[model samples]
Target: MTVTRFAPSPTGYLHVGNLRSALFNWLIARKAGGTFILRLDDTDPERSKEEYVDGIREDLEWLGLTWDREERQSARLDRYADAADQLREMGRFYEAWETPTELDLKRKKLLNMGRPPVYDRAALALSDDEKAALRRNRGTGVWRFKLDQERIEWTDGILGDVSIDAASVSDPVLIRQDGQVLYTLASVVDDTDMGVTDVVRGADHVTNTATQVQMIRALGGHVPDFAHHSLLTGPTGEALSKRLGTLALRDLRARGIEPMAILSLMARIGSADPVELRGSHDELIEGFDISRFGSAPTKFDVEDLVPITASVVHGLDALDVDEALSRAGVPDRLRKPYWSVVRGNTATRAEAGAWWPVFSGHATPEIAEEDREFVVKAFEMLGDPPYADDAWSDWTNAVKAETGRKGRGLFMPLRLAVTGQARGPEMADVMPLLQKKPSFD
Candidate 1:
């Protein structure tokens, strides 16, 4: 069975980009009857927080991306240590003693010679005593994985037929000088030990996947099939990385973007499929096909979500929003009809509150300067008491005959004067719910 995991660092809340990565892995697992693991790459304990861990869980739960198992890198320090020792024993891990300034100078020297600024691996030349002497001077050396100088290739699920020259890439540091096991080493150990069989992540991690693929084999673990999905951009194709902080799932939730709307759009935004609002998580999983996605950065527009949200709201059962209508002062007799009337006018459930006051208690009329006379005539025609379902049509038609008005000029003033807006649920439906008759006064 295919197994996948979404490994996120608990340093911050999740954004839409993060959602795409998480959902891709989740859909693969769900579609294959496999396990979905939530691995927290919280190796840097200094920056990771419990609140962020909670936030990550909250965001995933909000999106319905439930995980079967959760693994934290902080809890697996000994596992990483053992892997590091095994690599050192196999001559695949080596100590490197180079300060940032020294490495920068080496890079500049290599660039001056019209060469690639890859690591020269000078520390590999040092003998044991020389290394001890250097370590004694610099406290401790960082651990770097010694990559085989060859081409690394894998058939990526999305990008397909990927190859990288290891010699051109600098050896990744696996363990920092301060004894912190970096992501490069910790991820390999966890993914291998946890039986992660399929890896789906952002395009930015394609090079990282090549390095991890080698590490996994070095540790005698099966190499999982990998896919690198394209990154996201703004609606106009501007880089979205700078603005993702503001687009956190929590922020979007606060902005009233429904979870299903977000899930539906994310499941298809970069794919060949068009973005269609789905009714449930099962629908998203049933239709998910990673092969349909492309490597081009997909353009995402937050405003486009408005209509999808309206669509979601339009398909809800009266029971789904029964309590909300109760809280908003809709009478038991009026809740069903009230929801039917307002759902189309609303892009989100929050907008339902705006429609309540138009009928339940009070509404301020919005008559334009030129149409005030027409509105006054219409208001007087709407006499108090014994109003029916056809009261708006009856009053408007009578006013239309009396004032020689028709079309928008015939209807807009009446709509604005009564509901305080030019558009809403059919005024016929809005009229019966009105506890008080509207007037120009």
Candidate 2:
């Protein structure tokens, strides 16, 4: 069966780039009827933390992407060690006894000669006895992969055929002198051992693939297909990073962004395809295709996400909005009023007033007259009676019976009187709250 994996290094909060990578992987796995794995690459002991790993899992789940299997790279040290041993036995790797200072001098000397300062493979030509002596004498050194100086080429699903000569690439350290496996070695071993069939990750990992492909070939492991989707860039064209103040998923949710909004934003960013702004999770899954991903970097714009969210929010039934607000920790006192404004503004549903304006009007008393009137109308329609459980139907019926005037004109005056505003939350949301004793009616 086809299999794909999202391996995130648990060193920080789940950033937008990481989320995008996971989304693409999920899209491919779901589209192809393959297994999706979430692997925690927490190998950097000094930087990785349990909290970060937990946060990533929570973030992915929040985005509606679930993995079929999970694994941790740190827990599979023995597997990486075995791979390194096999490569060493097959003469595909050699222990470099050069100290940092020695390597620096070699690089500097090569640079002084106006040549690219790559690791000199001639340094690995020690005799068998000499290699054994150095191994016994040197207490600690890194193991470097011995790359065959030949051109390597592979077809990427997104980038088409990519080729790079081995001479231009460095013989990267597979295992540090401290015995901890490096990221490349551990990632390749884990992906192969877990039977991953497709690798979908950010474009930042595009250059790293060459070294990994060499490792896989040397170890006699199957090389999975790769698709390095473009990275999410900031407006200035720089890659998205924490230093750039990119928004986190939790932060967006806290700010009242609906999950579907976030998903829609994910679909649109760096995507060339025209996807409907509103759809169920299953609908999105069905429409997702790898070819839809754009090659150009996507700018992470919060403004672009607002309309998408509003579509999702407006399309939901009343109960769905209630549930979403409840999960967001919206207060009971503000729930009815907030939903009132949201439902009323659904027709306009402009990006500028979707969440904050609606939330502020409910939580604060600073709403405009027009907006407040809508709020009152909504509350009234939701069976929130005027003056202590007095329903609008009864009030309209009584007023019409006594004055011979219809219900339409009475709605505007009643709405204006209660909320002191003209165009805010609907009467449906306002009436229920106004039904409380000492009501404004």
Candidate 3:
């Protein structure tokens, strides 16, 4: 059986960049009839919050991306400690003491000498007495996983045949001096112990994956299949890292972006497949193929969601929008046809609240100065109350016949006088639903 995990730190609300990794893992697991785990990387208890964890769950639920089980790094401290001890016993873990400024100077010196700016294992050169003295002065030092100094390679599920020289890369810091386990260590331990078979994440983590692959092998764990999807950028291809804070899933939902609209576009934005609005989770699952995706940075436009959301709106049945229509003050009797009439004109059901006034509220016509005379004449011809499907045509025809006005001159003013707008659903369907009869003075 296949297994996958979407491990996120509960330090902030989920943004679109985060969802790309999450949805990929979820869809892969679902398509394989596998188990998908939602792991919380809350090792940094100081920054993690219960509210953020709740928000993550709420966001996933809203997207219909359900997880089978959840695991928290905080709860698995003993397991990580055991793994750390085992690595130490295997001589693959060592203590390192270096301040931030010391590391920066070392990096600059290495670059000046035209060498890879990797850790020089200075800690490994320290004598036993010197190490004891330094530990006493600086307290505990951070733990670094010693690398094999060879080429680490893997056939990536998406990028294909990735290779990294371990000699050129710094030994990863696994545990801080404060005893907090970082993502690299905790993820390797959890993924190994939890039986996660596949790992999918952003391209930025490809180097991390290369390092974690070595860590997994050292601990006698199966190295899962890895795929690094490209990162998202702005519509104009600007780096989205700075703008992701504003694209939180909650914000999009508040703006009335349909879940399907988001899911549909996200699933295909950088893939070879063209994005098509899927009506349900199953349809999304059926068409999800990670192999069809490329490694290029995907350009995402929030504006793209509007028409897709409108497409979703146009497909909804009456029951799907009944409560919305009712809330819009459409009498229960008329909601059926009311939605049918206005559905195409809306991008989301939330817009129905604004449209309700056109039928139920006073007709405040913004008649252009030039058309005021024709509009007043047209309103005079409109009969009082209880309109029908033929009311607009009948009224416009009568006005056209009496005033010698035709085409735009005759039709434009009547529509503005009656509905207060020039563009919307068919006037024929909008006429009978109007309860506030048009008034002329």
Which candidate leads the pack in TM-score?
Answer: 3
* Better candidate number, 1 or 2, judged by TM-score: 1
Clashes of 2: 32
TM-score of each: 0.96, 0.76, 0.98
Candidate 1: where is the Cα deviation over 4 Å? Answer: none
**What is candidate 3's local distance difference test score?**
0.90
What TM-score does prediction 1 earn?
A: 0.96
Total colliding residue pairs, candidate 3: 0
Task: Give me the displacement of residue 133 in model 2, in angstroms.
Answer: 8.2
Give the range of the ten consecutive residues with the poorest summed lDDT in model 1: 378-387
Question: What Cα-based lDDT does every candidate model obtain?
Answer: 0.88, 0.72, 0.90
On residues 1-441, what C-alpha lDDT tens digit does candidate 3 reach at each position?
899999999999999999989999999999999999999999998999999999999999999999999999899999999999999999999999998889999999999999989999999999999889989999899999999999999999899999999998999999999999999999999989988899999999998999999999999999999999999999999999999888999999999899999999999999999999998999999999988989999999888988999899889887788777777777888777778888888878787655777888565776888888877777767776679789988987888888999988777777887778898888988888888677745
Q: When superposed on Cα atoms, how far off is each prediction in RMSD?
A: 1.5, 6.7, 1.1
Ranking 1 against 3 by lDDT, winner = 3
> Sorted by lDDT, highest first, which candidate order results?
3, 1, 2
Better of 1 and 3 by TM-score: 3
The list of candidate 2 runs beyond 4 A from truth reads: 99-114, 126-138, 242-245, 323-341, 344-441
